[model samples]
Target chain A: MQQLNEQANIALKRTVIVAIFAAVAVVLSLVESLIPLNMGVPGAKLGLANIMVLTCLYFLRARDALMMVLLKTLLTAFIFGTFSSFLFSIMGALFSFVAMWFLLWVGRDKLSFIGISIVGGIAHNIGQLTAACIYFNTSKIFYYLPMLLIMGVLTGIAVGIAVRYLVPSLSKLSLFENFLG
Target chain B: MKRGDILLIGLVVVIALAFIIPRWFDRDSSEKNHNELRTAKITVDGKLFKEVELTQEEQTVEVENEHGLNILKIHDYGIEMIDADCPDKVCLSFGFVDRTGGTIICLPHKLMVEIQGPAEEDGIDATVK
Candidate 1:
């Protein structure tokens, strides 16, 4: 009976943490979209919400991180964007998640958070651009690829640095430690 | 920096440079042939909509489709999408295409504006086929 109670407590705590992360991701996405960082290019963004995703990936389970991504994408789209924007964002998030997961799994010791984040950024852009190409039915959209790549690298580095600082503090929290254990 | 960080940075730099260099050369040649841009073709849903001659007359072409409305401005130098109701506004950001072969596309509306060169060359190319 005691073990059952303990299991339920742990599950509740995990659910709470996941909800908190999802909320943070949504807020970050909203704030990032408010800034006019278009740089004369369409669909260019700072991707600040990626910080939360990276944090979740490193500290929480992969499934938890994916859940946060889905929540963030849907909520942000409903609040700040349109249906098309939601399509683009969901594609980007899925691609980013897959790339980050693959890199972290394969390069466990070989790559740092920054390297993985860069891969995530690149994958995100590729995913969005692929969707654009399919929708337009034209390959000329590739003209935007190089510029988006440059933007991705810069933003990825920024998000990675943020995660680097955030991870240590996050790991020290008793709640996270308890959940991990 | 770790080896991975160095490798990633190097890879990004190389890719950026590779794409930018060709575009830089293309821009130079296109600038030289600026006057070659004669007509602009607007297509919607893979069908021809309108063709505007790039002359000194500055006019606005309002395109309304199922998606929304787009305002295209045809100027002396070239043509551009001045405004669009599409969510992305990618077409508007394309600014102006003063060079032949340049295009502005709004994916949401399935609208495309492509600049064509002089009629003689286009006629010959069409006849050769």
Candidate 2:
């Protein structure tokens, strides 16, 4: 009974932490929105919120990672009134989670910026473009596929480097220690 | 860069070329096709709303829906979002759409711009949004 209670407490704590991260993600989402990259594309994003997601990953479980993503998506929609486009955001978030999680599994210890970022970037594009195709109801994804794929690689490299910069500091945090354990 | 780093750079260059070269070549053909005034479509939240014939000149369009303001620009044979109130200007930065396939989406606006050629089959998604 004691162990069950402890488990439930841990679960509750985990939920609260995830909620906090979701809030952080939302703040990061809006903050990043202000710092425009001017990358010369309509949808070109520096993918800023990725940093928060990566930070959460270092401080939470895979399930927590997934939850934070979904919560972030829904919340962003609610806040932005972009709920109608939730399908695209949901798909993109799911794709990014899978890619990031896979990198975590593969790198377990020696995670590289290039590999994870590459995967994350590719998955990001796939997620959005997939939603685009579904939204448009056409296989015309092929048209944007090439550019998006290239963009994925480039964006992955950038975000991967950012994550690499983050891992050392994040790993040192006591809050993150609970997550790692 | 050392031999290994040089090799990695070369590999990235190669992959980029594989994508960039094809797009560079196809750019012309797609541009040629887009020059004419062709019927284009707009969808909001998965519903087909309107189809407008696009001209080969710079035209500013204002689409006011419950979603938000959708600002469109048509230049030379391409159409894109010049501006939008959406937080993520992914649509505005998208730049242009060719006859092949392209989109400018303002999620906040619940607005989307899709271009399809009359002769171009399968470009239009059966489901609209």
Candidate 3:
């Protein structure tokens, strides 16, 4: 009975942490949207939510991270985006999650978090472009690829640096340690 | 940053440059062919909204639909999204697209403006001839 109770407590703590990460992601996206970082490239933004996603990926289980991504994507799409925006967000979020998860699994400690984040960022752009291409039914939309790639690399570096600092500090917290254990 | 991170960045930069350098050359070569006319085609929801020939006169086109409204300014040199009513206003940032393959897109409004050169490039040379 005591073991079951302890397991339930850990499960509850995990849910709370995931929820918190999702909330942070949504808020970051909201704040990011408010900032006019248009950069003359359509669909380009700072990708601030990536910081939260990367931090969650590092500190939590993959399942928890996936949950957080879904929460962030759905909530943000409903709150601050339209139907098309929802499509883009879901495609980008899923692609980024899969890429990051695969990198973590395959590379383990072999690859830096920054490298993985960069891949995630690029993958997110590709996914969004794919969604655009399908919706528009035109390959010409790919004309934006070169610019988007550069933007992805720049934002990826920023997100990676943020996660690098965030993960260490977050790991030291008792709540996270307890949940991990 | 790790060595791997540096390598990854280098690879992405190389790929981006590869895509961009060709387009730069294409734009330069196309500019030399002054006889070839360029046309800007704006589409909404994958349907033709309007098509304007690139000429000396500058004009402003206001596109109003149920989705949103976007104002496009067309000049002899290029087409630009001057204003938009969408939530993101990303279209306005597209600035100007002058080159043959250039484009400015407003995803929320399902609007896209594409610049097309004379049909010679697309194997439609018979029609041009």
Candidate 4:
């Protein structure tokens, strides 16, 4: 019974790990906001925090990717986005998470989080574009879609590589070991 | 190393496709709408006065009045103050905005000019929403 209690405590701690990554996501998001893309696409971003979310999906035991996405969406909305803006962000986050999850499932050990991250980025753009369509009620805005999608793939790769490097060392941490509990 | 991550990457690839497909319609929208829609809004002294539509057949400007006595013509890219009963036609100073989210404001005439884009787009089938 004591072993069972100890196992439960370990599980609880692992769950908290997902929140840690979510915190990392929030911090990275804030940092990226400062970077400010000069790119003409208006509101363009690299989405640096995606690395941490992807990493969370890989290293943690639980299905924490979904949780991380939820937390990031809620936190980022409260901090940087307007009430109306949250709808758009939710669209992006949900899409990106699903994309990342899909990549991980197919490739398994062969595909790195880098690949998954890249896919997520592309989805992120589509997600936002989708939100734009719903909000504006027209398809004309899609005139910008191709450029945004290409950008999404490239930026996803960039974030994914960063996650690739961060994951190994992060896994070494005791805190990380118990993160997904 | 999770299955979910693999699924996600596939989803992203599909999103890339979403952007690619739209190029088809944009080509038609731009090529076909030789006389694309022009959206405008006018304001006088920080007050909204009139919003007009200027078509693409050559170039021209129009002014509307509530009293029904005056009609103003605006030349190509030539947005100027029409004789408004207001104190000044300062709004006449700000010109046109054709691109997305473009706006022009006239302070004295209380005229504001805003060129709006297409009101709506077709449904988006990309991931998420």
Best by TM-score: 3
Question: Candidate 1 chain A: minimum summed lDDT over ten consecutive residues — where?
Answer: A33-42
For each candidate in turn, the TM-score is 0.86, 0.76, 0.94, 0.63
- Flag the better candidate by lDDT, 1 or 2: 1
Residue by residue across A88-176, what tens digits does model 3's lDDT show?
A: 87998999999999998887566687788888988898898889889887788788888888988888888888888888888888788
Which docking band does candidate 4 fall into? incorrect
Task: Give one digit per residue, the lDDT tens place, for model 1 in A1-181.
Answer: 9999988987777777778888998888767756756576666677788888888887767887888889888888888677876787799899999999888778857777788888899899889878767765666667777878887888888888888898888889877886442
Per residue, candidate 2 scores C-alpha lDDT tens digits across B54-104 of 776677777877766777777766677777766665676667675545666
Residues A1-181, model 2: lDDT tens digits:
9999978877887888788879988887788677857766445566766766766776677888888989998998787745546777788888988888876776645545555666575677678877777765656554555556556666766776777777677678654555564
Reference-based lDDT, residue B49, model 1: 94
How many angstroms is residue A4 displaced in model 4 relative to the true structure, after the best TM-score fit? Answer: 1.2
Model 4 alpha-carbon miss at residue A109, Å: 4.0
TM-score (chain A only) for the predictions, listed in order = 0.92, 0.82, 0.94, 0.90
* Model 1, span B60-123: residue lDDT tens: 8999978789999988668889988886566777887777667788767878887777675644
lDDT of 2 at A21: 77
- What's the DockQ of model 3? 0.67
TM-score of chain B of 4: 0.38
- Badly placed stretches (over 4 Å) of model 1 are A179-181, B45-48, B55-57, B86-90, B99-103, B107-110, B115-129
TM-score of B chain for each model? Answer: 0.75, 0.70, 0.87, 0.38
User: Lowest summed-lDDT stretch of 10 residues in model 2 chain B?
Assistant: B1-10
lDDT (Cα atoms) of all candidates against the true structure: 0.80, 0.69, 0.85, 0.62
List of clashing residue pairs for candidate 1? none
* Deviating ranges (above 4 Å) for candidate 4: A178-181, B1-129
